[model samples]
Target: MEMNELKAITEGLLFASGDEGITVKQLARVLDVQGHTVEHLLEELKYDYDNTGRGMLLMQSHEVFHLTTKPEHSPYLKKLLETPQSTKMSQAALETLAIIAYQQPITRTEIEDIRGVKSDRPVQTLIARSLIEEVGRKEGAGRPILFATTKDFLTYFGLTSLEELPPLPDDINTDDLEEEADLFFDTFSEQIDQSNHR
Candidate 1:
């Protein structure tokens, strides 16, 4: 097919998919062309989007492609993603969720050790929210339940997979340990302080 025709059809397919854009391999399979051809076409399309004053552009990550509105369009996009009443969790819950996501299959006791406090309430809240779940029981003396992140966690965070999580520094230092401890306290301390204040 002609280049213009290819671009048009590809854009049409992307639009038809809405938030889900056709990957290069999928497009190649559908068009009976090589994957490189589809990739070249996508590159050309991306250039067009960059040159033209279109309201949106294409993005690829975690083996998926998507057409998203330009960041400049956030004010309008907010009208769609925003809700009347937003759901929120305590900071303790957020910390527990992060730890579970990073160190999955870890037991409540391990989490407590990291946080240096009981994590029952936060773990319960995360489980209730479907962000974390009991993966299985640990093989130990007590056989405590192990927790891990759920698919809902990825969807909620707009991540296709947990592998997309940002990389952490490999170095270990006193500052790093102090920061982790501070984070643990900061997460739970505010709520405790607020209740104490009252």
Candidate 2:
């Protein structure tokens, strides 16, 4: 195929891969081209995005290439994400998020055990909002889905990384899981407020 055709195909593949991204080796194999040739094509594609001033850009993290929105568009993105309809996370959802944030990669059964209630609805809500995602599956009888927070979780809470979360109180008892979740949510909200002011 022509270089232009190859570039277009690569762009389509990147878009299809979503945030997971395609690796250089994967692309090379798929395109039946040398690794260096794939690298050249990726560079050319990156140049096109930079030169054209598109809202989307090609990002390569850990050797995986993906298409992502440019940072300059974050304000608009934030607006869309924080609109009235989407901004209202229910108390259950918040509790679920707190558990996922702290106890990942936890399974639904584990969350229910801590909360002392079935968490299917709240889990669904968090998944729908993209706050938490299925990171993997457990190695038990059912191989239950393991849940974890997504990058969007960090962005929503204005956290650069999970390590920035407030340390749990040393005196806090692990038996009071609900209280622990409440404290986590409170701390997360305060951090978000602080970040917004900056």
Question: Best TM-score goes to which candidate?
Answer: 2
Q: What TM-score would you give candidate 2 relative to the actual structure? A: 0.52
Using lDDT, give the best candidate's number: 2
How do all models score by TM-score?
0.47, 0.52
Clashes of 2: 0
Residue runs of model 1 more than 4 Å from their true location after superposition:
1-86, 173-178, 181-198
Per-residue alpha-carbon lDDT of model 1 for 146-184, expressed as tens digits?
A: 889999988776679988875444653434543664554
Q: What is the C-alpha RMSD of each candidate to the true structure, in Å?
A: 16.2, 11.0
lDDT score, candidate 2, position 139: 80
lDDT of each: 0.70, 0.80
**Cα lDDT tens digits for candidate 2, 1-198:** 899999999999898765456888889989999999999999999999999978889997656788988999978977876686865666667777887898899988788777777787788678767889988777855456789999998987768998976677789778887777677667566654564455
Off by over 4 Å in 2: 1-83, 189-198
Judge candidate 1 at residue 56 and give its lDDT: 76
Q: Give model 1's TM-score versus the native structure.
A: 0.47
